[model samples]
Target: MEIVRPHSHRNLFSSNDAASAPTIPLYRSAPPLEVRLEDFESFAIDRLRVLKGISDGLSRGKKPDEMEKLVSELWKVNMRHQHASEVLNKDIISHFVLRLVYCRTEDLRKWFLSMECALFRYRFRFLTAEAQRAIMDEFDITCKAVNIMEFESIKEKLGQVARSMGQPLPTGDAIFYKVPFEDVPELVAGRRVLLSQGYAYVAMNQVVSLVATLFRSQLSKTLILTNRKWTSSIREQEKHRLTPIVEALCSSYLGPDFSQPKEYAEISLKDIDQLAKTSFPLCMRHQFDKLKEDHHLKHGGRMQLGLFLKGVGLNLDDALAFWRAEFSKKVGLEKFEKEYAYTIRHNYGKEGKRTDYTPYSCYKIISSTPGAGDHHGCPYRHFSEENLRAALSRMGVNSRAMEDVMNKVRNRHYQLACTLTFEALHGVPCDAGINHPNQYFNDSQKILQPKKDSST
Candidate 1:
C-alpha cells in the first residue's frame, strides 16, 4: 500500500498570537514539511517503542524509580533528538499513525488510548514550568493557583489535618491549586485539604494527577472523533501499511512468534513436566500441578495452560498425547477421545476455524475473572489475600517479601507482584518487566541457565 502524504490542515501551522490562533490540533495527520518517507514511518515506530516501554514498565509494577529512569532514557534517545517545535509535531504525527492502525476495533482502541495516556503523562511530568504554562495556554487548561493571601485563612485548617495524617504542613511558600472539589477526591476523602464553598485546595505536587486526568479525558474524546474519522477509510490500502505496526505493537506486549514453532520445537512431552516445574510462571505452574493431581482442569485452566504449553514449544501431536495420557488415567482413553480430543486439536489449529492461537499475555491472564472451581487466572489477582499469602509462602517466599507482594496485590499492582515473585524465585534482579507469560517463562529459563566460561 502506498503511504500517501496527508493534505495539510490549517491547525498544523497555528500561530502563537492568541488573537489569530486556531484550535490546537489533537492528532496531526499531515507529515512535517522536512520528513522523508522512511523518516515518517521510522518516527512513528520509534515513538511506539517508547510508548510500549512505558506501558510495559507500568504493566510489570515498576517502581517510581524505574518509571523515572524510563522517562529519562526516552527523553535522551528520542525527544532530545528533535527541535522544540518538532517535539510537539512528532508527538502528534506518531499518534495519528497508531490511531489509523488501531482505530478499527474496540480492543485496539482501548490499547491505543492506554499507551497514549501513559506517553502523555510521562512527557507532561518532565515539562518545565514555562513549557507547561505554554502547553496549558495552548490547550485552554485554566487550572488556577490559589493566591497566598487568600490561602492564609485556610492555613490553620490545612495544618490541623496535615498534622492528624502525620504529613508535614505546607509552608507559607507552598503552591496550591484551586481545583474543583470533585477532582482531587483522594484528598477530599482523606480530609487532607480545606474545602471552602465548592473548590478543593490541593497541593502543587498533586496537580499533575489532575492534569493527567484532564489530558486523558480530552484524548479520549479526541480518539472517539479519530475513530469515526478513520474507520470508514481504514480499508485494504491502509491495512497494508498498518499490519506490521499492529503486529509489532502486539509483539511489544504479547510474546513473539506465538503461532510458530521456532523457540519451542525441541521441547517434547517428556520434557514438559520438568520444564513446567522449573520454568513456568506461578499461574501456569499451579495449573500444571492441579491438572496432574486432579486429572482435570476447567475450560479456563485448559485454554490458558494449553496455549502456554504450545508457546513453550509443545507440538500438536505431543500436546494431544500429553493431555490424553493424563485424562485417560481418570476417564479412560475412549472417554478422553470423546470429550477432550477435539478441543486439544482445536487449540492446535487442527479443527474448525484453523486459527493458530497464541498464549495469553500477562495482561490477559491478570484481567480474567475465573469462575467457581476454575484455577486458571493470575494467582495474585484470582486468589484471596489469605490464599495468595499461603501460596507464596509455599513457594519459599519469606514473610517480609510476601508482605510486599501482598501490598502490591492489594493495590491492584498484580504485575508488580509477579515481578517481585519472579525476583524472589530466581534470586536476582530482572531488568525487564514481565508483559507476557511466555516472557515470564523465558526469563526464568535464562536466569536458571548456567553461566558459560569466558575461557571457552
Candidate 2:
C-alpha cells in the first residue's frame, strides 16, 4: 500500500506543503484489502486498548495535557509500527473492525463514537496546519473564514466571549471561521465563541472544536448506517466466521490474566479475612462479609468471590477447602462435598469444559445485574444510593470522602467512584484508577507492603 507521510518536523501550528501531507483519517470508507485473520484480530485489539485508555483517562478527570501524554504512551506501546505504511494500514483496518464490532448495540455505538472522537481530537491536535486544512477540504467541512469587515464588526463580542471563557482576546490579525451555530453547539454552550445571526465566529485555536464537531457528526451517521447494513445483509452471510470475531471483540476482556497469579503474593485461606479488610475492593469486601455472616452464598456471589480468591493466589486445594469449610457450617460436609465442591473445582478448570475462568474486571462486574438475593455485581453500580452510602460508612469512609464517591456514582462513573473509595481507604492517590477488583487488591498490597528495593 502507498502511504503518504506527513512532514515529521512541521509544527502543528505551522503551514506545510498541503499537496504531499497525509491527513488524519475520517474512516469514511473501508480499506480495500484482504487482511489475515490474525492481523485483523491484533489490529482491532490494539485499537481497543487505545480507546480503553482514552476512556479511562477521561473518566479519571485527566486534563488535556495529561490525557495527551497518556495516549502518546499508549500509542507508542500499542499502535506504532516499524513502517509508515504498516502503521497506516493498521489504523484504517483497526477502525473498521471496531466499527463492525461496536455497531451491534446502542450502548456499544455510543462508547465507540465517544472514544473515536477523543482519539480523532488527540491525533488532529498534532497535525500540521496544512494537513488539517487538507482534511477539512477532503471532508467538505466548508467553514468560511470571516472577512475583515465581519471580523471588525464582531471583534468586541468575540473579545467578551473570550474573556468569559478565560481565553485571551483575539487580535485584529487573528483569523476567525464562520460556521452554523448548530455545528458547534459545545463551543456556543461554553461561551467560547461569538454568535450572531445563527452563525458561530470561531477563532483559529477553537477551530479544532469545530472540526471535531464535524468529525463526530459524520462518524455518528456512518456508525448507524454501518449497523443497518450489517443487520440487513452482513449478519446472515458472515455468521460463522467474521461475525463471531466481531462479537468476541465486543465482549472480550483485554487486560491481564488474573487467573494466573504467578507474580502476586500467595494467598492462603487463613489470610483471607485480614486481606478482605485491607486489600479487597468494596464489591469483594461486601461479598466476603456476606459469606461469613450467612455461611452460604448464592451461585452469583460464589462465582464472583470464588474467582476473585483464585486471582488473589488461592491454590486449587485451598480453594476447595475454603468453600467446603464455609458451607459445612450450614450444610454438613457430606452435602457440601456433594454439591459445592465440583463448582469450586470447575472455576480452577478441574471440571466441566476445563476452562480456567478469569476474575471479573470492573466492567464485567458492573455489567452484571444482581437480583434481590444476589451479591455478585459492583456495589457502586448496583446498590441504591442509600445502601451505597451505608456500605461506605461501614468501611469507615468519612462523610466528605463518601460524598465525593457518591458524586462520581451519580454521574454513572462506577469505576472512578471505586477508585475514589480506594484512595479514601488507602490514603494515597490512585492515579490510574481501579479497573478490576484484583487490580484494587494488588494496588493495596503494593502500598501496604512496599518492595524492599523501592524502600532502599
Candidate 3:
C-alpha cells in the first residue's frame, strides 16, 4: 500500500464523520489502509442452544444456583461484547463526536506509543495543522516536562475547551446524577431495580467493547480491547438517548424519496378506491381488499381513514401536502418571525415525525410485530402486497403506478416504505434523558482509567 502522510484531522481516522473533511490531523508520517464503502435471523437458533443447556442444568441441578452460574456466564460474555456492538452498529458515536483513528499496523504500536506525546494539538482541516501540531507538542511536553494529567483531568480540561468553543460535550456510555437512591419509589420491586442496575452495568461494558469494535471498523482493527465484562454499566444510557436519533436520521435517509411535481396529483377518494385493486406491499393491498369486499367501504370511507388510519382517499402527492401542513401548523407558522422555525421547515418540513431528523431523514419504526422484539414496524418485514392492496382499496387509494412501491417491499427495500406513504411522523425532539438517569455520560474514568484490562 502506498503510504500517505498522515495529516491532522484531514486524513486520519476522523471517528464517524469521515463523510466530511477531517478535523484532527494524525501525527503519523504514513497511513496503512484506505476506507471507502461501509444477518439478523438464525441468531435465535444459536441462543436456543445455550438456553437448552442452561435449562437442563437448572432442572437437573440446584435451580437458583444453576441460574446464578448461567447468568454470570452470560454476563461475562455480554459485558465483553454485545452492548458496545449495538452502539457501534447503530452509528451513535459518530453523531455526537468527531472521531479520529490513525491507519494502523501491528508493528507500529511501539513506535506510535513512543511518539504519542504531542497528541493533543494535532490539528485537522477544521483547525490548522499547526494547531494540531501545537496540541500534540503541548501534550508531549506535558507528558515529559510537566505533570502527566490522568484521562479524567484531561477530559475536564477538554470539556472546558469544548465549552469555550461552544461545541458539544464529549460523551461516554454511562451517566451520573446527584439524585440519591432514597428518592426512588418504595413500591418499586427491589428485584426489578436490581435487574435494571445489572443491565446498566452490562451496558457500560458494551460501550467499551463497542468502542473497541468501532476502532476496528474505522481503523481496521480493534484497540483497547475488552477483557470479560465492561462497557455495560454505561451503554444503556447511550442506547436510550441515541436510539431515537439513529432511528430518525437513518429513516430520513432511508425514507422514500418524494417526487416533487410541478403540480400535485389531485384525486378524489372515489378514484383511489379503484386503484387499490393492485399495489405494492401486499399488506396494504390485502387490507384494502378486506375493507372493500368485507366492509364494503367506499372512497369516502377510505379517504377519511388515511393510510395510517387505513384510508386511501387521497393519493401520495396530496398526502405529502397534508403532513407538511400538519406539523407546520403544530410547531407554529411564524416562518419569517423566528429562525429556528425555518430550520424546522427545512429539515422536518416534509418528512413525517422526523423533521427534527438531522443529517439523514432515516427512521426505525417501532411497532407491534412478531420477532421485532420491541423495535418493529419495518415495512419490508411487516408489509404484504395483498394486505396493502386491500387496505388501500378500502381507503380508495387511487394509484396504478404503485408498482415502484411494490418493488421496494418485495425486495425488502424497507426505507422505501416511508416513501410510498409520503407520510413521515413529526421529527419529535427526544428529551428522554430528562427522565432517564442513564443517558448522562459516566464519570467512571475519574475513578478508573481506561486501560488494557479495564473491562475486567
> Per-residue lDDT of 173-233 in model 2, one digit per residue for the tens?
8988898999888887877777788988877777788789888988899999999988998
Off by over 4 Å in 3: 1-266, 278-281, 296-305, 308-456
- Number of the top TM-score candidate: 2
The parts of candidate 1 lying over 4 Å away from their true place are 1-66, 72-90, 93-133, 136-257, 261-264, 451-456
Q: How would you order the candidates by TM-score, starting with the best?
A: 2, 1, 3
Predicted candidate 3 versus true structure: per-residue lDDT over 313-340, tens digit per residue: 2444454344344434544435322533
Output the TM-score of candidate 3: 0.25
lDDT of each candidate versus the true structure? 0.72, 0.84, 0.30
Error of 1 at 146 (Å): 15
TM-score of each: 0.62, 0.89, 0.25
TM-score of 1: 0.62
Per-residue lDDT of candidate 1, residues 150-199 (tens digit): 77988988788678878888898988878788776656786777788998
